[model samples]
Target: MSAPFVLLHPFAPFPLARRTRWLWLGVAALALLLIAAAGQWSARREASFQADSIHRAIEVHALALRGAAAKYSYLPFTVAQHPDVLAALAHPFDPAVLQRANHYIEEVNRRAGSDALYLIAPQGTTLVASNWNTPRSYVGQSYANRPYFSDALAGRNGQFYGVGQTTGEPGLFLSAPVRQGAEVVGVVTVKVSLQPIQEAWGFVRDPILLTDAHGIVFLGSVLPWLYQSRRAVAGSDLDWVLSHQQYGAHHSFALLPWKMDPAPDLPGFRVQTTIDGKPRQFLAVDEALPELGWTLTVMADYASVTRARERTWMLGLLCAGLLLLGGLYWQLRERRFAEQRDARRELEVRVRERTAELDEAHAFRKAMEDSLVVGMRARDLDGHIIYVNPALCAMTGYRADELLGRLPPYPYWHPDDVEQHWHNNDATMSGQAALSGFESRVRHRDGHDVLTMVYTARLIDAQGQHSGWMSTVVDITEQKRSALRQRQHEEQLQHAQRLASLGEMASTLAHELNQPLAALSNFASAAKAFAEQGRQELLVSSLDETAAQAQRAAEIVRRIRGFVRQRTAGQEDCVVGALVANVLALLQGEMRQQQARAVVRVPADLPKVRGDRVLLEQVLLNLVLNSLQAMQATPLERRVVEIDATVADGRLHIQVADHGPGIPAALAEQVFAPFFTTKPDGLGLGLNICRTIVESHRGRFTFADRVGGGTVFTLELEVSG
Candidate 1:
């Protein structure tokens, strides 16, 4: 006996009720059996419907393939059934007559994309050919032995499917005899490609197995893995089908049991229609093409059919059980009287005990609710707020009474966050999206902002129906403030570093400016010399070269101004290599002053990045200057500074390393800090600014002490591509 049954006592008032309850149990059992029968019947009905649908889909595929094959047959007949070749072959062909035959072959070749077209003479000699052999090799070649030529020559019109002699592809060969006074004179041969027919059968999802009339599979597109394992229609299951009488008919169905040995078994199958020779099964649908003696097939797993049937059965069972219980409870009043009396008395006792339990549960729920640190709110399926916990009220600075049932577009949500919050929250309420946590911001009642992290899940009601969503939110305001301040400090540091770079390069700037001015003077002198000698070409080339040099000078001055000058803060897309080349050109004189040579190793295909060209150049200039300074103490051979630009982790990386002594290990981290320095008369802002510039471009800057003596500084900037 069950524990609930044992707990019930058959005392004076309950003895009669106990007897009556047993009578009702019997009635319930009868009702349950009827429900189960009805459920299975309904399941069988739905299974028939799905099977019918599969059958229709199979028929549609067969019609489509037949139509495609018919087109292939029609094209060859149109080309082969022409009369112009009949008249020409009636008489011995002169060279002119043979040339005319070639024109007919060309016309047929164009009408059909055939690989072979030819005309056979009455004497069994090939007269003209197109796409047959190079230079019409078969023109004078004998066709006395070939089936296509001889069969037509004997006054028969027919077609043959064979492989090509040279191309070795499946081809449909059609031949029709040209008649003269009811006697055959010549045969027209047309060979067409069969690739389109294979393509038409490719629409099926599963493997296709096409067998000839002799039960030999001639064409197949089986799955690679299954092909490797060699499990196919010719295997055991198919052999069993062939042995069974049910499979021997034009249309009959059977379910056979089989095991999948090496592979774990999926849901077992409930097979549908089966047949042998006939093409009721999709795998053999086009097993016999009247023109080509070929077949088309598509094979699907029987397990899928069974699983679909099972799901329909389960749905039917649930619906039947609900209907049966509702009908029996309403109709069987007299039979349940004694049982009802006992149940009422027991219910009275349970109600009193349950009332006390409910009171205790309510108190526990309140305690749990108070302990929550995140803001909590619940909304019904209709999108009406049902409750708001104290934490939520405290977060939004509103009382619980003010928030409950106040529909969304709640004043506590920021305008920008409102749409996203409702969209994400509604997904949980509608039971469409999984319970994924999201982050958003809400406006406080006091007009301040509150960044929040929210987690939510759906709540189901007593009837096992989806009811609402309950969301928990936590404040992230402090984290947001910290990030904001950090970004501001980085921007200030970057600005100070840019100013310091211009100050340090002031002397180098003067030397760089003098270059174009000197070039202009030389070009002007050359023009004067050419004019005096009456050399017109020299004057023209000299003036052109001077203008080019002047433009170069102007560009250098503009880059210097752009570097030192402050402009509006905005990021522009620039290629890393192009921008680096401009910087190297600007710093060419400064590099020469230190007797240091620079090697720019930026790849030509480097990705473009969004950044301020001036600030990026400043960072590059600082690293190059540092390299030049470090090499000032080294021998001439070690003075080369290598600047390389590459992409890593979806970002651009600029690495500057010199061959001179590397930085001391102790100062690596300190080098980027404001006012930190290792050199005499240094403000130590270059490395710090480099870090700031990189960060502003959404990047990072780092320095590593070289294995030798010099320092290597790297700047990283993001590349959207």
Candidate 2:
């Protein structure tokens, strides 16, 4: 029998009290289960209601969008059949017919409130436009590439939503064939801006988005949701959207840079993200707008669902608490009748338990002594071992039989310490000095000396007479050697740090001197020309300017020292073109030295990036210099480094490509580690620091081999607005 049951079995309690307790518990559990089931049912009902409401709201917005689209739907077709439009299409270049058609279309556009009304020739040229007086007018712009133009020329009415090529504004473009008798002559086109429809959605006070067939969200109630993609798009498909500038200069279709995870076993997803530094959760639903070939996604506030669930649980808990109180009152009444007898039997059980506890404790002490990490030994006053634990035997690599009952000069005592061990034991037995702490070396069975810590205590019997001495030993060899090695390592580490600091200081000074020294040379040469021309005033101004520039060069040194502790450089928004031009100016000397040619490719309207200008200049300068040095073995004529910059997916990607021997694949991963270098004289921090600066700005940098045979380093920086 189990000890607990055997002990309590002799003195039993009233059986009805146990039954009463179980009955109350069963009732409480049943009520709790029922409450939980009801709450779950209510939650399901609310979720279904929410889904239906979203479907209805999406349907309402779809109708509203169709209504707005219908307002100007027939305007394109009506204008195509006008007598003057047909006549102008037939005459081709007749000024009178063109003037009449333009005036007629302009009047109709003004009355219809359309953004633009234009007449396209059969050759796809715009002959007239309603906004001819505006700066972004499309009077003579070519529309041959537009899908709407081709569809209309093929004798079918077509509708499209895209960014205008001439105006760069997003609008719905509609076109219809202008028929001359039984043949298509030209096209009548009308463009209606989508700004009004999008603005109208803002009044709905909920997140409602409309995406085209391509899943591009061109119209939306949420400001951040506009012009975003509903799903991930591959590079090829994204390139098509970018090539046409479908939605102005925007990159990427992702509504959020992160993917949203859908809730398990639920119809809607739960998105948890930070808003204004505080976390928020949103539940969203998607529906299709079949009439317009668009998909509508509506996001609703889910706080209400949570609130309802909380209320249900709160009510259920209150009811359960009331039922528990009633059960406790009955339990108090039933406690009075519990059996009250058998004092002698309880006393007998207690005595047996006490005896068993003592026996268990003695066994526990024996096991602990045998398994201890520190060695324990006891010896008699006559210097003969009386007792020794397994731990002591293991410490000296011997069996208990070999150590127990051994004499003062034990086999485990080191030869060099044998006299010291006996002298300490004699003192302890005589009480000349009260068994103090000491250290000594011991010989292990493996025949090696190990440093051990020793402490002695008196082993007295029940009569309080000294019977023996107890000694505990521990191995300290590893600890002593570790401390020595640590001291040596710290000294070496300090020296290495000192060397690194000096190297950085020298490198910074050299780079800072290069720029100003070059400028000073140019100024001095110009000064010579001024003096030769006998222009005293110009020469005096040049001398003064040169002096100021020389002082500026010294400031660079002071700034670098001051910036040692400041890891993040000062940041400002910078234009890509201007940044490239400045860095190329700094690299002219390096290019000349290496006999390398530099070619820069950047778009004028490329997105601006945010970073510290000085730090960025340093990063670019290092890359260019590396490229120049890497091609030192190449023929002078073939030493070309191409600097290319493009904006895509909200990132400004800059590629520095060189035609030279590429890095070996084996060493690529190690090149970025501090102190790892390829060149004999390389500090290896050039690429490391470049990557550090880029990462500080939340950007990335990577390296690859160019297709023709060289290396290409790509730097990706986030675009600023």
Among the numbered candidates, top TM-score falls to 1
Model 2 alpha-carbon miss at residue 257, Å: 4.6
Query: Best candidate, lDDT-wise?
Result: 2
Model 2, poorest ten-residue lDDT window?
A: 493-502
Residue pairs in collision within model 2: 229-253
Tens digits of per-residue lDDT, candidate 2, 602-648, equal 88878789998766766676777778878989998889989999977
Per-residue lDDT over 193-295 for candidate 1, one digit per residue giving the tens place of the 0 to 100 score: 6565456555655445544433444344532211111223445545443443112231212212212232112211232343333222221122345555545
After superposing candidate 2, which stretches have Cα over 4 Å from the reference? 1-13, 255-278, 329-721
TM value for model 2:
0.43
- Candidate 2, residue 678: Cα displacement in angstroms equals 88
lDDT at 621 for candidate 1?
82
Error of 1 at 111 (Å): 36
